[model samples]
Target: MNRITLVRRGFVALALVSLVSLALVACGDDDDDDGDSNGGDHSTGSATIGDIAIEGAYARESVTDVAAVYMTIKNSGAADTLLSVSADVGSEAQLHEVVDSSMRQMEGGIPIPENGEVTLKTGGLHVMILGIEGGLKAD
Candidate 1:
């Protein structure tokens, strides 16, 4: 085993570990039958922001550096958009949608049509919290 070969083996091992971590993060709880994945006591209830109401705001306990936030957004007034999401628990918050069994970061904002509602749930549209500080504790 030469020095160059050892270095290449090390790099390969590191890459494999990274890929496994990413795969675990991408695999969400598919058995969440109730849409919400956080189970009981995770909800923050409902909050009204102008004509837009956000309900069932919750996040599942994170096993890694990322967690997804689920909620229901209802717009009773004119059409609007969810430009972004910010939280003190994480360093980066991104809007993502599940496409073909993969989570894709949504560019721009998610549109909220008038008199319509959008549900962010498991295996659907959600807010991904990356670089979670102190991790997400289940309460």
Candidate 2:
């Protein structure tokens, strides 16, 4: 298989593992709200990957099989492109753009200009998570 196909298969396997693990952990009361009961913070983190600084990463509580992740990607060095995104909880992850009230998948990836930042937010460019495992839980 080609590189893209291999990546997609990896994502599918990850999603399947996530689903099974989530199911195993879905037992017990889910009404606790101490912000730490879910074993990890659901909507907050920061990380620096090479010259790219990613911050404010979070996903809304998903009630369905789909969800989105919002964050700020800043490139401090040479220009780069966001080719693809993979997640452990989704079978497919895609970059999308919202235009004129319609959302569409982004092809060839999104460009990250040098010394610039891209904000992925609602009604804007964002990462769409397809086939989310057990949906996202609110924390």
Candidate 3:
């Protein structure tokens, strides 16, 4: 073959080989394993620590220096779920069941079910954190 023809053929071959390699690499990347499972992103992490799984967890306002942490403790086995909770930046943290009254109001700790959820919301029940510290976040 002529020198010019050989050079042109070599360049074309190199370009074609490069395009084929690129196509292979791109195909491998398009696999369905993008770390996003079928459920969702939030469903990836399990909420269980030891014997409790806290779900829908949130905190309350700080106007009265009191806050709450709510969660659904699900027991995977046939056993009683006795979970204890605490918080920093407070003198005393108590498990309180807030009862709404027309005239007088009351608060105290209550029992949580074995394999169910116990809500600590307004007008139902919540945790009364006494003597808050410097800063408190709802996180």
Candidate 4:
């Protein structure tokens, strides 16, 4: 074959290899998303532990073995609620509170009052994961 013909064949072969590689990479990305497609940002509906209804429960970055899981606990019944949280990874998990003292900035305030509600988010009282599995995303 002419030199020009040989060069054309080589270019075609390279393009085919590239296309296959791209396809393989795409398949791998899908494997990472099962019920966790949101990358831990969005939510997976309500998480019911016993009678308590945990609304808007979610975590970010599954790769992080220790994730700060946050949720809104809604007490629907007439009586007040006193509850605690537990994760298999952490040795001890406490129900924290964030308060703004007269001097210091807002931080882990006091323990949740009896039948009181608390929000664990950025710069607020959060679930202290004493230990973690891999990496915990504080964000």
Candidate 5:
């Protein structure tokens, strides 16, 4: 066989193997009914309190005993404040924000404008879950 033809065949074989591997990895446990596609305790859901609605809420896996939570807060009425946060899986939960490239506990809470929304995500604002027992998992 010509060298160019052999090279093409090898590339196709490699591509096929890569695709199969990806498919196998994508097939996760079906028992995860918490609507988290990434699996494990990283759950996703929505909730409403008074005039505010929290959407797309989810937690991240912990490296040690600390994890972070991300979500979007929408206000349907007057402006509101997210004073604090709590989780049963952790000893303490607090609102945190990044300021000038530094992370600190957010004092006075996060403000949500009237009829506006606030997204708490990485590198900005998020919820810190401290003293998480047994750590967190995403599998």
Candidate 6:
């Protein structure tokens, strides 16, 4: 019934929502065919948007108002950039990277090389969700 407990519960709820969103976006067929015959070995938990493929998207638990999301992006065409990330559970979302063990917001976005891939994981690049609604309850 204290303020701190309520805040922690809100963070937990928000993290769960973010995780579900990532899972939904990354869910797809394992048949290497992302609606195309390219036969590029696209595995399970991968979804294609245009020439961009997203795989294994997930989020970490939150004890505060911020949460982090991780994933792998594969580019099958011209190079592209990841400008930003959004989640309904928070008021702000940003692309972040860790430098010298410190976290900072990424400027100019993340680049995906042509025919290459980028992995966003802990201690590296990831998405940060902030200002999560405090009304959320764990129950």
Per-model TM-score, in order, reads 0.69, 0.68, 0.47, 0.45, 0.66, 0.65
What is the C-alpha lDDT profile of model 3 across 1-139, one tens digit per residue? 0010001111221111111111111111211211111211111112453444544443332333433333344544334423223444466555555334321122322444556655544345544455555423222
* TM-score of candidate 5 against the unseen true structure: 0.66
Ranking by TM-score: 1, 2, 5, 6, 3, 4
Q: Comparing 1 and 6 by TM-score, which wins?
A: 1
Model 1, 50-90: lDDT tens per residue? Answer: 56676666565665577777678887977777766655555
Pairs in clash, predicted candidate 2 = none
Misplaced by over 4 Å in model 1 are 1-42
By lDDT: ranked, best first:
2, 1, 5, 6, 4, 3
Superposed Cα deviation of residue 126, candidate 4 (Å): 3.0
Better of 3 and 5 by TM-score: 5
The reply for model 5, stretches above 4 Å from the true place, is 1-43
| Candidate 5 clash pair list | none
Model 1 lDDT at residue 79: 73
Q: What is the lDDT, from 0 to 100, of the residue 105 in candidate 4? A: 24
Error of 4 at 43 (Å): 2.5
Best by TM-score: 1
**Least lDDT summed over 10 consecutive residues: which range in candidate 1?**
1-10
Across 1-139, the per-residue lDDT of candidate 2 in tens digits comes to 0011102211221111122222112223323221112233344445565677766766555555776666787879777777677766668878888888678888887787889998977677877777866776642
Better of 2 and 4 by lDDT: 2
lDDT of 6 at 103: 83
| Per-residue lDDT of candidate 5, residues 7-123 (tens digit) | 111122111111111111122332322211333433355656556666666654444577666678777887666666655556876888877767789888787788999998766
